[model samples]
Target chain A: MKAAEKRRITRMTSAGRVELDDAVAVEKKVRVAVNGEEVMSLYCSPERVRELIVGLFMTEGIIEGRWCIDEMTVEYGDEILVDIPADGKVSLDRGTLISGCLGGVTFSSSAGGGPAAAGEVRIGAERLRALFAEFQRTPGLYELTGCIHNAAVSDDERIIAHAEDIGRHNAVDKVIGRCLIEGITLEDKIMHVSGRLSSEMASKCARWKIPVLVSRAAPTSLAIDIAERSGITMIGFMRPSRFNVYTHAYRIL
Target chain B: MKAAEKRRITRMTSAGRVELDDAVAVEKKVRVAVNGEEVMSLYCSPERVRELIVGLFMTEGIIEGRWCIDEMTVEYGDEILVDIPADGKVSLDRGTLISGCLGGVTFSSSAGGGPAAAGEVRIGAERLRALFAEFQRTPGLYELTGCIHNAAVSDDERIIAHAEDIGRHNAVDKVIGRCLIEGITLEDKIMHVSGRLSSEMASKCARWKIPVLVSRAAPTSLAIDIAERSGITMIGFMRPSRFNVYTHAYRIL
Candidate 1:
């Protein structure tokens, strides 16, 4: 993969003052091909393409894990091929193909139901506060453009994996994809994001069977309701010392 | 319309020190219905629902102006209903439904095709810088969340309409939607956002045929390329005294 170049920008403030700083950004295209057919084109910064692919697959529930990945190749240019170990009976649907330049893929849930995982999980509020404190200190790509969101996977006390993208969902997917490729179990991990907690975010965590979620922003009512029913611990407005436990507050000591 | 109720939050810095004052936040749900049927729900602060709805419509190209809106009502405690004059001859396709939460929505672009008025608009960089200076002074939501993105529609030196949302795209959409409902002409206005100039943002601006886009953040290479091809002036890292005019610099002087 080619490395992204950084540029120096001179900016003036609202007060009519000028300051110079360095900004990092990249441009690259990744053409996803399934069964030798192009599905969609993605223009993104050229880092973490493999993790992005894996994370996208898992979050979209297209493939279960590394076991389902028959063969995967990432070219130096703009192509990625992922062969899934699917039976001959499984057919690809062209109707679901959607093109996106910045965001991640959007998929529909199966007809029989909504999210498959149970709705409720539990975690300590203290742990969440600590995790968020650590999260705030971590350097992120967003602080560069003031446009990205960060997602991190953490155990009780420490964040294990983190990714940043212009989209919050993509950030989470990237981390999830990394864990899948590294053979890490998400059974007890907490997913943290810098954006608001929405129903979709909750669904992504529930789908992965992640037990806990902490966010620096507020949660939508639907997300709170979903978390309540799904048996997941949902915490929001997280800061270093205080946070709101929306669902399963009992998990927090 | 329901009145916005403010909630106070105490924020802490990364060093574990609490800030001096409490930040206020508002909560509201934006129900987006097409032709009387609810399609998607957005839970955001109640400050700018009207603009949001209008901007969304404009960017989606569902309606161009107030003439297209047969009736519009914002019922407190219920939902906002926008009745666009629909023609039986135009059949809407359900196959294009995009799902995901804020993060998901941020990454995905409207599949309606590129900007409706791509090459017909331009604005001077000095005027854009002046607009940012004035916009920053407006006491608004972002001063509280430190996470929201602001969107504004301006004509030359005057800002006719402005709105802020937690999501940058939503902010722009809200402004566009406002123009449609209020019968404001976007043909001569410039769009400004508090976030980066990504391809998605530029696409939305192009769709509206807004002549120029100014931002306080950096622009992706694709955004610059799209602006160059579309004849839209893309300005980034905008400050009161100086700004970078990436495309169509001739218009800035």
Candidate 2:
């Protein structure tokens, strides 16, 4: 697959040593330039090229004015080249973060969509678990390479979108961008991931006001705080039949 | 421990439901400013505050001139405030990454070290596994929270320096910085990480001219390429008694 490549490796077990072919995840640099300004270069699995850029720009607020994916030009190969044709300038002076609030808790100024507004949507625990299980099963990247992270959007019923990347945050960005371009509304949606929930992960979900965020790993303290304040139903440490809810338990009935 | 905190969580198991106090990894925003420019703000477990900055600045080359830990000012609390009081400046135009090489296998322009040099260090399979096993057991943060990534610098005999963080890259940076400040030589040393071997991770070890990189996880394709080109012995998927060597097998007897 384009996302992974088989390589020869020597495995040494207690009994003996043998040469075998192992699937290694493929990661390449994707340099996204907005207008004429070179924004940033990040490495990720070479898939979901468009979604990754859009989601990154939207969440990081790297753009100045209204933008759309239609204005993006992508060239995929050894490296991914993306040029944003909109008035989106690289003008988010993130350097001013120095003057941010000093409470040990600082949210990115470019928080997407602000905190999630309360909705009447509620999901049962079993349904949430099943949805996450289905989300895990669909992503073939992790099983193949063992180092990939997957992210998906779902409702109480089924998954709506999914993407995989070498980086968990990049996976999240890919899914967010896919949903945005596909005209999929993120409201009252459950965002599931295959990695730990960090502060940045929690904030990404908050940016879209995602109602519930679930991961198959632990959540950091700042992640829990962001979920609590943003009204997100934060769930983590999700196993085959169990999970932990750290915030907005009301939404996880 | 300061790296982790106990928090109330609702657990939903297949057998039953209950509320429990679970240890969650602590993550706080640490905004780093060099000279007077707010370079960037990141989230990490609050420890090794100085090592992290030095390692980060040195590895990424975010600063221009010489800097010292003694010239740094830090305020620790709910969050961390770090001001680099050196002739150091945050003038690295990483945004110009747009004009980088088009090969999908582009390395970062600020790659700390060009590559690992050929070294005379040779470690047997058993010895390398034992060293990694020792490295893994020493990080209490992971056992407490299961989300922390630990990185350590070690010789064939013993682990010399170690650090842990919520982010794997941050952990690696902390260790690198720790070794730098402690004046530990990186030549012929092995850098062990408790996470996937990604391109950036491989490059980080290469930057320090570390001859060996071992991980208790799988490696990405680009990582293998970098390791091979840099002449580093890359080992991954390390179990208690089993491991895979992907590059420079000469270093593993």
Candidate 3:
């Protein structure tokens, strides 16, 4: 395997110039297959194919767990083919394919319901503020490439699983996938996203049964509504000292 | 009609404890329906629904020009309904309906033949560099929000249309939509984007027969390959004074 090379960029400012070098990210297209049929194609960094595939399957609701996947193959050049067992639930439709600029694929279903009902997970105002501070300090892939979104699953005091992607939804999917692969229970975890807390983000968290969702950015009204309905604690505009709890404020204090 | 009320937010910086007040953006969801069928929902600033609808339609290849749209209605809370005459070529699919986070949706089609054919318009390298300098100064939205992409279509010496959006692809679509509405010919226009020259971006330009596509960011190898086959001029890492023309350099100088 060839070692990945890093590029050093030099920028001249009004006063002086600065030089920074970071790892170069190469884009590769992976074709995910299930049961000998092509499912979707993803363009991503080549670092962790297994994790990505496993994560993609779980988060996309393709497979419930690793046991559902019979075998998988990662071909370097054009695509990564993943073959699963012949299950009755798996079927492909031309119309079901997500036709868009980012990684093009489709979920088996719309994955739409509402926010998941909040369960036993709880966090105080101080803990939430501290989590935001630690989240800001966490290393970001986007700071390196000026691209990528980060998603983390945390407890009251510490973060457990963190993933980054060019797409916000992808980052969440990766984290959920990691948790499933490692057999980590997501019921008590707080999900943190680098992007805004949109309805879709709230919906995804609901699907995973994660109780709390936090973001460094704003949240839409729909997101707040879903959070209210789902009983999840939705926090937004999180900072080191202050934050807005959109729903379930009673649990925050 | 009620006037759109803008909210202001105050924030304190770490340096000298400086306080700053900035305008808070209002987020609204606009559902777009083509011929009585709901196509997709977009979250955008409510200021430019007419332009956004037309631009989105043209860029998505839903309508070739303004003539195809018989009538369009911008309902306040519901969908932006557009009436188009029944044509055999136009078909609507609900399954593929996807929501854009902030930027609009970019639909990717399968890579069929090759790169798009280059147009008849040609310009000198010095003039192209000058245009890049002007393009850099035109991202007003980015100047305000620090988060947006700008797209412009220009001829040899002057810019014809410019649009900015949270998504780079949306900016391109807005420009294309504006061009269609104004009966501006894209044949002689060179496309400039404030984001990376990805394959999807290149594909959007190709679909419109826009020959030259320039960006201030890096290009993927697949984008270069497509540009080469399409006979389009692909320029990446574009600075005010310099640019790397990957394919079809003959038209650049």
lDDT per residue for candidate 2 within B153-203, as digits (tens), equals 998899999999999999999998887766677877999999999988887
Whichever of 1 and 2 has more TM-score, that candidate is: 2
* lDDT of each residue in A31-144, candidate 2, tens digit only: 888775677899998998888877877676666654556657889877888887654346565311111111232223334544454655698888888898899889477888
CAPRI category for model 2? medium
Give the poorly placed runs of model 2, Cα more than 4 Å off. Answer: A93-115, B93-115
All candidates' chain B TM-scores are: 0.72, 0.89, 0.77
For every candidate, what share of the true interface contacts is present?
0.16, 0.93, 0.02
Residue B163 of model 1 has an lDDT of 82
lDDT score, candidate 3, position B24: 29
What stretches of model 1 exceed 4 Å from their correct place? A7-22, A27-43, A62-67, A72-130, A136-147, B1-54, B57-67, B71-85, B88-127, B143-147, B181-183, B239-245
- Expressed as tens digits, the lDDT of each residue in A151-171 for candidate 3 is 888888898888876556667
Better-scoring candidate (DockQ), 1 or 3: 1
Worst 10 residues of 1 chain B by lDDT: B99-108
The residue-level lDDT of candidate 3 at A202 comes to 77
Model 2, residue pairs in steric clash:
A78-B104, A79-B104, A104-B78, A104-B79, A112-A207, B113-B207
Each predicted complex: what DockQ?
A: 0.20, 0.65, 0.14
* TM-score-better candidate, 1 vs 3: 1
